[model samples]
Target: MNPIEARHWISAEDKDLKTVSFFHLSFPEQRAAFEELIQHTPAIQVYDTIWQQLQELMKTRHPAEKLSPDLLQQKAAAHIGNGPADEYGVWVYYPWSQRLVHILDEAEFVEMRTSRNQHKITAAEIKTLAAKKIGIIGLSVGQSAALTLAIERLCGEIRIADFDTLDLSNLNRIRAGIHNIGLPKTTIVAREIAEIDPFLKVTCFEKGITEDNIEDFLQEGGRLDVLAEECDSMDIKILSRQRARAMGIPVVMETSDRGMMDIERFDQEPQRPLLHGKVPDDLSYTTIRQFSGEQRMQVALNILDYDNISEKLRSSIHEIGKTITTWPQLASAVALGGAMVAHVCREICLEHNIPSGRYYVDPDQLFKL
Candidate 1:
């Protein structure tokens, strides 16, 4: 490394650790020394932001006590690295951030992380959702719902399934970037959730849900609190509902059309039919997979009430595989679906009175003549 480059690299490390140092030297002399340091102390240097924050928090917690900041820092230091911190408060480099960060220990992290959610979730409700596991199928539109749930801290864990990879076409609806091209949809969703809150457990089904794995996906290890079904495969959608119903797990689905969303409280009403009995309960998976062009269009019509969908979207459905590659979708509609489904998920998990039915968030309808 050149003298300037080596010094720049060494200085970053030195900033975090007081003992680490580098001698100013010529390019040639610095090369050997820099290489040695790189070989030996390879750990990434991270800022002590969490430590600083915790100290500040202590001051706020005891405003009238007037405790010494140094004393509080000393007390907090012992508890800092014990939980979520990287092996006891050790700093690590995060690729996404491209910077070093102190992974706050889990408890402190939770306290600070969900502090903003206080009046909204309440301490009791937050605890309820934190212990629940949510299963999400298909990461394209489901990406929005999963992200919304994560941001709200609505569930303790999330399981996602998607066999498809990120394609440029998905950008119109799926929240992703060109850098995510060709990556598995599940991977992108998982990374997004982890970046938001590393403590939340995330499980991925890269191959997508299948008959063989469907059972385990729903209740093999731990049953899901709610199932958010959003996938292109007609068969998987039906099959997932059957499994969720059998396991007494409530189901929620968002259709990126007319801002429509469906909620099925199968847990509360076990006999409740899938999609409000829009299609036959006994519809075989094989039959759906082999659905002809016209048959698929009819199914779409039945699922999304023909009368309620905008005329433009209704006409666009007929052009699938001809003028259009697939059903038309907009980022606005997809994002709205995500937020709506997230709200329903929280409601169902908390045993709120979210009835089983189809609801529309159509802005056009609301402002109609």
Candidate 2:
């Protein structure tokens, strides 16, 4: 194949990439596999930070008591059966980056990584959050939310969906590098989460959420504790909520404009109207799918409440096909939206009393004199 075609072929393969692989060196078969990986991939970069992590783990376990260097070393040695440091824990391999990391096993690694989140996120709360599963439907603002959720180790499993691949235009708001262009958005988010904590389960629906698969996405394996709906598709925005309400799963959405966040506590009030009744119950996905471009735009505006939008965004709406190609989104807004969604998701999973309604965290208004 020509070089150009070959490049496209490689990118397509990347879209099918899987989660990071972990091998426990204590097992003979896994050790053999690691040896084979290193032998064949001579240039693979290896990182062994297990010793440092062990030190941190020991300190966290004995915060009130002071242990000397020798005592700490002895404790660490006993914790790992006094085996060679390299063979004590799991070795994770990242195929995309051709790098290998040696770190503590799942439980120990998680303890050390989230030790700082102690009082802020209590021990009982951590266990409760870990058992929860979250589903995210879009990859633009959803990317930021997924990362924040992963970093906080807020959920044990995350299901992400997006049918689009990375493009140059997405660089303005999506948190991805140019090298990722053409890779599926779901793949990018899943891979990043794996790098953060390989033990966390991530399921990717590369096809994005559609009528045929929406049910499985919400109910398969286990019902999601919360759903973060950030997709722009009007049908999905409405259809997903309909399904979530039926399953009694709460739904949270963040529009980058003015950091507008909408929460539908369907779990608490299964009969809560979709979008706080902003969307008519009579409106079906079938009808929404066939709406003309102008009609669809009008529906979207109604959902967002045009009167409440920032003046600049309201003005930009008229220039859709003139000065701009579509609605404008800035990196700052997307990042803020991610944090907002994550914070709300965590609260909902913890059963906090966040009511069903629309809330805005507009920086412009907050910072105004």
Candidate 3:
């Protein structure tokens, strides 16, 4: 193949991960498609564990029915039309990985996969969360937030935006491998979410959020239920909240320092000042965009509250030009931020009273001697 053709092939493979294909053996055309796919895909890994999953589903469904083991097996078989066990459930094909996973259909799959959530999440809560949509910007710390949200099945759809590509330096906090370097941060996060739960919808904004596309990101498909702003761009940070407040959508941000998490409930108080009024009224996106490097850092520090930042971060900020090129973030802090953001987003989506505020989960302060 020519260079152009090879590039096209690689692009097609990358795009293939955007969706998953499912085949139910009960349908003749679908069965044929599945057979053809496996036949042509060399060395494809096939996994068949539908029978055990079905058994578990049966146990979950009839916890109070008290059926015998044999009776439960018969019930599982009967629910899927008493078909052969081999032909049961649906076959999920992951084209990027060349693997076919045999599992329950969407309904049963979600039921069994989230069964452990139980009374903690409740069936009603799960259904409610399934209807929510979340938007995230800046995939460094945002990567953790997105993955944690997906793993928890917090929302039905997630829209992630990050123009920056993965770098060797990103591996310290971003959960990506060396091979993913040069790939867009949005793509890495989206592909990881797809792998975890193919049923969840993920939209990627490869160009990142800009003045031209910020509106579309927040309202095009549907108004975002929550916006997680974690980008490094100060201008975009202020711009996103401005737009989100105008649209009355809530925004959440994790600074990865002192375990600081910021939630701006724009939906609750549409007129609320940005960053809880940390940003002065005179400061606008256009003005901030023109600031010099030192000016930008000062503005960011002021927004984050210089007095509240951890000592390590304050020291690191001083070392930017001398010892370090930028601010330092630990994997531990990033991971904690991801979980914190996910929890806060979940609460907001569920209509809980998570008011606009700044909270910290600092380990040093919590576990001090």
Give the higher-TM-score candidate: 1 or 2: 2
Q: What is each predicted model's overall lDDT from 0 to 1? A: 0.75, 0.87, 0.85
lDDT computed for candidate 1: 0.75
RMSD each, Å: 9.6, 5.3, 4.5
Model 1, span 215-328: residue lDDT tens: 877875589999999987778888898888888999999988878888899999999878899989888777888899678667767877798888889898778778998878
Minimum summed lDDT over a 10-residue window in model 2 is located at 1-10
- Per-residue C-alpha lDDT of model 3 across residues 93-114, encoded as one tens digit per residue: 7765788888877787788767
lDDT of 2: 0.87
- Which predicted model would earn the best lDDT? 2
User: What ranking of all candidate models by lDDT puts the best one first?
Assistant: 2, 3, 1
* Regions of candidate 2 where Cα sits further than 4 Å from its true position: 1-16, 67-71
TM-score of 3: 0.92
Displacement of residue 42 (Cα, Å) in model 1 is 7.3
The true-versus-predicted C-alpha distance at residue 307 of model 2, in Å, is 0.6
Error of 1 at 204 (Å): 0.2
* Candidates sorted by TM-score, best first: 2, 3, 1
Residue-by-residue lDDT tens digits, candidate 2, 1-369: 111110111122444275466777767777787899899997899998787788778878999989988888778778878577788878888888888999888888888778899889998999999999999999888999999999999999999998999999999999887999998998888778878888888888888889999998998989999999999899999999999999999999999999999999999999888888888977888899999999889889989999999999999999999999988888999999999999999999888889988999999999999
